[model samples]
Target: MVSITISAAKRTSLAKDLPATLNFPDKTVDTLTVSDVKSAFAAKYPQFYPSRQKISLKGDNKLLADEATLASVGLTDGAELAVKDLGAQISWTTVFVIEYIGPLVVHPLMYHFPSVFYRTTVEHSLLQKYVYAMVMLHFLKREYESLFVHRYSHGTMPFAYVFRNSFHYHVLGGVALAYAAYSPTYANTSSYIVGTIRDDPKFLMGGALVWLWAEVSNLKTHVTLRDLRPAGTKTRAIPYGYGFNKITCPNYFFEIVGWLVVCVMTGSYAAWFFLITGTYMMALWAMKKHRNYKKEFGKAYPKRNIMIPFIW
Candidate 1:
């Protein structure tokens, strides 16, 4: 038998009483994976589910992958491992659903019930109607993607993030943007006046075309990423084709472009604000994902900008 010491690097109230050691049968030690060690650890401390546990070799900064064999990672008899609690976790699907539901439902209410949102009913112009349709279409596509199309690497996220994400979509993207675009102030803007810049058929048509193009390109990028990993697995493969050739995260790039198109179409300060903030956040995400791809694939990974093409 091979005995391994298990110590809590960061202990929670529930993990304070966990046992200090786990034993592996001699026949299985060479074949046992990090996941097996986690399973054994969870058997003793049920509160630390596999997803919420971060395990590393004792005194080592690098984390152990669940799919890696203990022997392959240089673990042998008397090896010591440290476990850190990741706190409460909620499924990525649940977080996405919650985040999207707010915008999906709130934006329409703001559009249709101006009295409720703006405290008075106001006639919506044709341009406002068009903008509203685009917003609805965008969120609908997102909701669909979250439920059926997108695959997440980590199964769960910290529960606190759900509220932050929801606020960004619901408050900024839905309520604030809707009010700014559909309100009396927007209708009275110089661009909305008849024969003005915003009233030009060519401008509206061009904006619509760009928005549609961005949305479709974003969906294609997402599908390309989805096909890289099979369902029910966290396996990752380098994505190619479509926007992947030029940018690390084409989905984020396309999404930002779509929102920017909306801001142009609507001529709303609130929409522009939402686009700017969303773009900043997406850029951060793209940079992080780019770093991870480079780290994972080294020289084999394609050289590309993080999000923007040609220039980042």
Candidate 2:
């Protein structure tokens, strides 16, 4: 058996209550994993659950992987480690449900109860009806994927992020887009008149085709990612196959395409705003993931654009 020393970082509020040094009594350098250390720490300090702890070597900035054996990471009999509190945590599933359910519910409410959102109500146009169906279908697919298809590496995220995410999906993407598409002003617009853009069969059919393709392609990309890490494990592997070949985040690319289709179909400034903001956020995420893949896999990682196929 080996004794490993763990010290809590001073940045956390719980640091005062944490012991200056914690010794693992039942673990050996070769046999123990970072996850085992976190479990032991949680047993001693209940507030610092494994999900809320970030552990690393004392002088190293890189976090230790839970699945990596201590020996593999160069930890020995007298090695020292640092632990940081990740603050309050909420389940990833819970956060996703909260974020997506808002758009699902809010959009329908605005579409069906126009009086609540606007002073005057107009008869729903065929274009508005098509947009409504697409919106519901898109969000429902998201809910299904979040619940069943996507497998998260980390079980929880910072609780503070829930509100920010919800506001984006609920208020902006849902309510704002719904109002812009279904409002009386939308019905009165010349482009949406009975013989104009909205009435053109080609425009409606083309938009629907693109939206459908994007949605299906996005689902495929997500499934590709989900299959990379087997169920009930946090292990990550460099992804390959369709969509992965050309873009680091084809899921984001397809998602942006789906939203762009909606924006063009609705001709709503609000929809454009949603698409732009969402694309920017997804781009940031794609760039970060692309860099991480390069760092983690080095030369073994394939070359790919962050999101767009070859243009980016």
Q: What are the C-alpha RMSDs, in order, of all predicted structures?
A: 2.3, 2.4
Q: In angstroms, how far off is 151's CA in candidate 1?
A: 1.3
Model 2 C-alpha RMSD to native: 2.4
| Residue-pair clashes, model 1 | 0
Clashing pairs in 2: none
Query: In model 1, which runs have C-alpha deviations exceeding 4 angstroms?
Result: 26-28, 188-192
RMSD of 1: 2.3
**For residues 206-272, could you state the per-residue lDDT of candidate 1 as single tens digits?**
8989999999999999999999999989887899999999999999999999998887777678999
lDDT of 1 at 134: 90
Query: Which lDDT values do the candidates have, in the order given?
Result: 0.84, 0.85
Which prediction has the highest TM-score against the true structure?
Answer: 1
TM-score of each: 0.91, 0.90
State candidate 2's TM-score.
0.90
| Candidate 2 per-residue C-alpha lDDT over 67-144 given as tens digits, one digit per residue, 9 for 90 to 100 | 888899987887788898888999898899899998788888888888888876677777787788888999999999
The TM-score, computed over Cα atoms with residue i paired to residue i, of candidate 1 is 0.91
